[model samples]
Target chain A: MQGDERGAVMKPLRRPRALPGTATPRPRHRADRRPRSTLRTILALAAGGVVATGVALLASGGTYALWSDTADLAPATITAGSSTLTVAGVAEHAVEELDLTLLAPGRSVTTPRPVAVANTGTTPLAVTVSTIAIPDGNAQLAEFLRFETAVDTGGGETCDLAPFAVAALTGESASQPPVTILPGEEAQLCLRIGLTADAPASVQATSAVFSMIVTGDQVRVP
Target chain B: MIKRMSGTLALVLVLVLSGAGIGHAYWSAHGELTGRVAVGTLSMTQTGVDGLAAAFTTDVTEVTAPVVVTNDGTVSAPFALSFTGAPAAAEGTGQSSGDLGAATLVSVWPAADAASCASVPAGDAPDGSTSSTGWNAIPPLLGTLEPGGSAVHCVRAVIDPARAAPGDTVVVTSSLTSGIGSWSSTSTADFGQSFSDDAIVSPHSF
Candidate 1:
């Protein structure tokens, strides 16, 4: 009975229907409709890897010139003033030169003070200087007194009174600059003395003994 | 794929850390304790004299300081010497000539004036400033001067005896600089040479 009914229903269905130009529809595919797990995983992983690579490149790309600068502040300065002399500050100016002695005697000759002493002190002080030193390890008052005097426009004079052959500064005196401060001072009442000239041809034998005695208590240099 | 990705990420991180480490190291570097005059003979002779002294000039004329710059360091360094009135000599040419050079050369200045510098210290770093104790007028520089290399600089400065005193000193300074280090040398000469009223260019026939 099933075959007889199927035969009767297929009689019209078996007949060829002709249209103008349309082709017959192919059979539908079940496999094409299914989801692909492997492909999905691969694409997700590829996208993640690309993102990671991009992040890495940004991290290492450019260089920034990171630097720091500082102002080497000029050291505090102290100058010599009038009757009132206050020890304001101190500074050091140093220069060093080296020479090759291949042809002659290769000696590192240092001409510490080639000229007269540089004007290291700040304030203008009218100082009448005398030479006092300890010669041969003994305190003595030398006879020769050399005074380098320059007339000041404001009645202020500076002199580096050196007794030609004295070596050390041992004792304190009223005529010379003071070596020690009384109290309430940061540094001693010292004068700014430097080697004025270039390196000397021959180093002088005599050591320098400057006995600085500040007369006025309130002298401050700019 | 996961393994490859992990490897690449690890490599990238390592590179970044390495670069930072280098920069930090260089920034934190410090200097190691390494490191390290004459005058006269200035005169000129000319025909005819001014009415007073003699048929020829008889006054202190010029101050010439002949200097030899030597490099004593173990490493090679480059150097450049600058002056106020003259353009510096080109690299390897130890002398400057003519007015352009003379403009950069220091002429009339006090011995203690900061404008007269002679030799630049040896170094590769840029000075950008002058040394406090060095020759004063011109700013200082440390280009590069090789170690053990020596350069000579001469200043032919004429002074008028009528105006310039005999005992006065004319100072010239220069610098020799190398990698990160510099050396300054100065020459100061007393004024006592033949005088010519007019400015004469001496023939540096070397």
Candidate 2:
């Protein structure tokens, strides 16, 4: 009976009865269903292959050139150059305090020791008066004070206060006309500080304390 | 799947562009130095006063003193002279109410020498004499003096015989003041404090 039940379950799947008066039913093979399933599998594999190809092209920087030329040039060992600016033998990031006593109204005083701005680096630098920090209490004195800068080119040139006009320290942070120094070279900077003749009486016997920051930037040559 | 791949590509491109934007840097070096400057001073000194005291009588009623003023400070300023004090009668004279100060005439003039200052005659106004009664008079500016400069001035006083007794004695104190602009006072000594100005550059790394 189990053999007969197995044969009954497989009989319709193995062969289907044709309609009446139709031609004799052709024999159907199990291989007939394989073509459709094989085609679907191939389509899925093709889609996956296309996606993978796209990802490969995108990942390789999208270089579409099929041919490229090669050049065998000598490699360069770049030695990074340095930029250093020093004032009075003192390097940057350091503070030096100078005392300029006996400043009188209608008179100007120059630094006894000329400020030496030296370029100790490997590259040329452009030096400039960057920022001036005047204490809030001495702001009034700053108004009456005049500052002048001159570059001494070693030709008997001196710091002349008569040529000093309205420049730095007159409510301005920096002065104009930046001085440039070559590598391993130094420049003498003369600063003349003058108290105007019309300075008020309140500024007498008072002190003005301030800081000046000078900056030197590396000059890049094209 | 293609849409998702495009989204991934766009995100990667954004990251690459952002990395390129922050690649720039600069090299700079700076030095900073501080400066301190103190203003000079204005002052004068009464170096000498010759014959400041004198006895007066009805026959000889005028006296003169040579006051020497020197600018001892670092600046040039004008100097002025002012007098303060009242005249008093001699002790036990019972003439305490005698008003000799009211009747005395005080005058100042720039003199060439001490001898010439002492020789100024009574009842005669000398050249450049600031003649006035001591009461309610503005101090006279003698002259401007540069640093270490000196000036000699004669201070003469005369008594009016009609307004005072023979024993009345007037002692006057003189004050010397030096002034510039709005600042005026007695002499101020130098503090002798020293200060200086300087600057430095800053160091920067790239």
Candidate 3:
């Protein structure tokens, strides 16, 4: 015991001194390692969202206009022209205006009279002649009545086209072809109407009326 | 930051591929359209030379005249030659010999384009099929006549007087049937026998 006490009393007490620029070990706390706010994390997430939205918008914008085109179609229009005809004159004179209205069986009335056919319209017309009314149902009565046309022969009233042609309203006009009249054109022709000697008694006191039908067509633009 | 950028790039790619699956499709922007018709007209005209003023007789001589039929309408017409008002005739000499029914006629056309007829010999009847009951058979000579087209023909008859009787009284009418319409020339043949024999030359003027 006396030796231990003497050894402890003889031990030297020496302390080490800290030199300059020496680094000292520090305590690392969990809280000290972390950033102060969540601003950095929020910025990172927002950047990722921006990239996603950009890609979506670019893809969709291009797809919509790929197969589209436009053009201007031509327009169409339609119109109509006038068509008309008139047969009012007799032998170079207007019959209705002349007021000469008695017809005799033996003599041909209006023999020297020239009938004028006028076509007044912008377009041409096909004119047709017909008897709207005739003397009774006895068609034979019409056969005795002669309707004749004359050309401008020096002698006058003579038909050179065909000799002795007779038009007794034998429904011949009903079978007649249409006559063409040019726009603003007119025709003056000789007409002769008479009851032949063979006319029957039934034909007496008979009357007739004539009418003209007109037709026209449209011309297309070239 | 780099890791975040890379994660964002991957997320964008997934979104793009899934766009169609999420009801995405191409969008497009949109138009409709309709001509004219009218009825046509037809017309015809006819004329004769020297106006039929003379009576036909058995003179052993032929009478000739230029006759023209015109298609004045806008449409083409196929025409038929025909006769109207039956005429009486007798082939024997004396009063009965002047029968116009026995007489034959020739229609010779001028300007080939106007119309056509059989090449009948002079003083001979025209070489064509006769239809005393109805319309005569028209040769292809007269084709479909267009507007402004004309049919020209010379109607002639050769008869010998004295031997050919003088009692024939007939009024022969030459007619053209085009479609439902008809045109006629007024010409009469009188054997100097009777006024009834005279061809009542009637011109159906339009």
Q: DockQ: which is higher, 2 or 3?
A: 2
Q: Where does model 1 sit among the CAPRI classes?
A: incorrect
B1-206 in candidate 3: lDDT tens per residue?
66766876787788686874556332111000000011123455556633332344432234455557777654455665444333344435424333443443434444343223334455554544222311122232344567678777655443344333445444446655555222212222222221222344322121
On DockQ, the candidate that comes out on top is 2
lDDT of 2 at B2: 53
Number of residue pairs clashing in candidate 3, backbone atoms closer than 3 angstroms, sequence gap of 3 or more or interchain: 45
Instruction: Write the residue-wise lDDT of candidate 1 on A49-166 in tens digits.
Output: 6765565556667434598667888899886332222222212112233112110111112222221211223333333222233233312111221212121122122223322221
lDDT of 1: 0.31
State the lDDT of candidate 2 residue by residue for B71-123, as single tens digits.
Answer: 88777778876666454444576454344566667787888766787576667
Worst 10 residues of 2 chain A by lDDT: A92-101
Q: Which of the two, 1 or 3, has more DockQ?
A: 3
In model 3, the runs with Cα more than 4 Å from the true position are A1-222, B1-34, B49-53, B56-60, B88-98, B105-107, B110-142, B180-206
What ranking of all candidate models by DockQ puts the best one first?
2, 3, 1
lDDT of model 1, residue A182 = 20
Q: Just chain B of model 3: what TM-score?
A: 0.49
Q: Compared with the true structure, what per-residue lDDT tens digits does model 3 show for residues A105-217?
A: 34454433444556565665544444322424446545555555432323233232322234335334533344455667664444555556555444434454432222222
**Per-model TM values vs. the true structure:** 0.18, 0.53, 0.29
TM-score-wise, the better of 1 and 3 is: 3
